[model samples]
Target: MPNNSLNYHNCKCNIDVMHLQSQDIPLVARLYKRSFQNHFLGHMGHKFLTLFISEFVNSDANSGYVAKYRNEVIGFVLATTSDNPFREFYRDNFMTLVYLTISRFFKDSFIRSHITKRLGHVHVALKALFSFSVRVRDSREKQEICLSRQPRLLALAVDRSYRGLGVANELTAEFCREMKELGFKKVGLSALPWNQRAISFYIKDGWEKEEASETSISFSRLL
Candidate 1:
């Protein structure tokens, strides 16, 4: 059941924020696919997208939250509280990853566009692995300040119809409150450079830009 219900901007309707559960994966996957229609994960197909969201929920149920309106899930936030999230994710879901790779390689589209994107994922994973290793070798100071004990907001999406009703704000505020109770000094998140709406939302919510690059911008806030 949802933890509690909240009014959206003094509206008559209420939104419920709760811990994400296994049963909500399908609905969340569909919402994610719709929210990020042009993104790579959306293009990975519904089955793969479901599996992707499942990993986050399975990894740390306490760190994930869902927003429901009228008993229907309308948005979700998936995050990792582990210090080494990538390594932990690979370790926990290695078998699934292998199966998906093999199946996609053989049964998926053989067209150049699809094949290229699939290969691109492999290249990106390898590069990220190498980058992680290097960061581990370097001092903690050199690593992204946001990668500490604080939880990282990995993915967040809301149904288009519910975008401006303060669902995102409530979800984030609740997560930060939980993190503070767990003794975290700060919480962090990142967004693509082009996601100006997300960036503005974070800024207005008291998060400060901690780092930036051509590809992404990282933000953190004291909890």
Candidate 2:
């Protein structure tokens, strides 16, 4: 069985944070879909959002957390401890996300018939092959793929209504403290660079960006 009943609460907000139960799957799915859709709605579409959330929720490699106010889900984080769920389709998702981004380039009529479509297939195939090869190599190189025995912070969101109330900070800080107490050297996150608020918050909270591209920034902190 999973850790279905951990008492996760925001000390600053004084609200209970629920460990996601399987029964909460639908609600979790809804919140996740809504939260991400709201952020990337124009960039993608309902189909993409739905697909990603479903993968996050149903995957064995992943687990989820949610923050609620008055029993209504206000925030969520979806995470994978190791590589299980992704080992299967990691490359698929990566290629899909990339394709979704560069698809406009395929509009060139000259290449659409031969180079473009073929390139997309090749990209996906190469991604999958690379993913599989890496996992096998990693497995052979290491005795164990040691993951954080402590809970890791995954995707975290504060509903707009709860955004400015410090709930996000409180939840993240608490998770960070938990990781430190569990002897983790640091915590990791990837924030979209466009989300200045999130970047600012992490920086203020002592996290630093390792790399920033036009799209995303990787963040980490020593516990």
Best by lDDT: 1
Q: What is the lDDT of candidate 1?
A: 0.72
Lowest lDDT 10-mer window, candidate 2?
Answer: 1-10
What's the residue-level lDDT of 35 in candidate 1? 86
Clashing pairs in 2: 77-155
Model 1 agreement with the true structure over 69-175: per-residue lDDT tens digits: 87789889888776555554444455666676566556544422456545765555554445544344444553344345678888888777777678888788778
User: For residues 1-223, what per-residue lDDT tens digits would candidate 2 score against the true structure?
Assistant: 1122222343344555655555555665565555654343223444344445555555444555666665766666666545344444435566565565456335433333335334555555455657644443654343234433323456777765566666666667666665565456777788887777878888987887788888678888888
RMSD of each: 6.3, 8.3
Q: Which residue pairs show collisions in model 1?
A: none
Alpha-carbon local distance difference test for all models: 0.72, 0.57
Q: Worst lDDT window (10 residues) for model 1?
A: 3-12
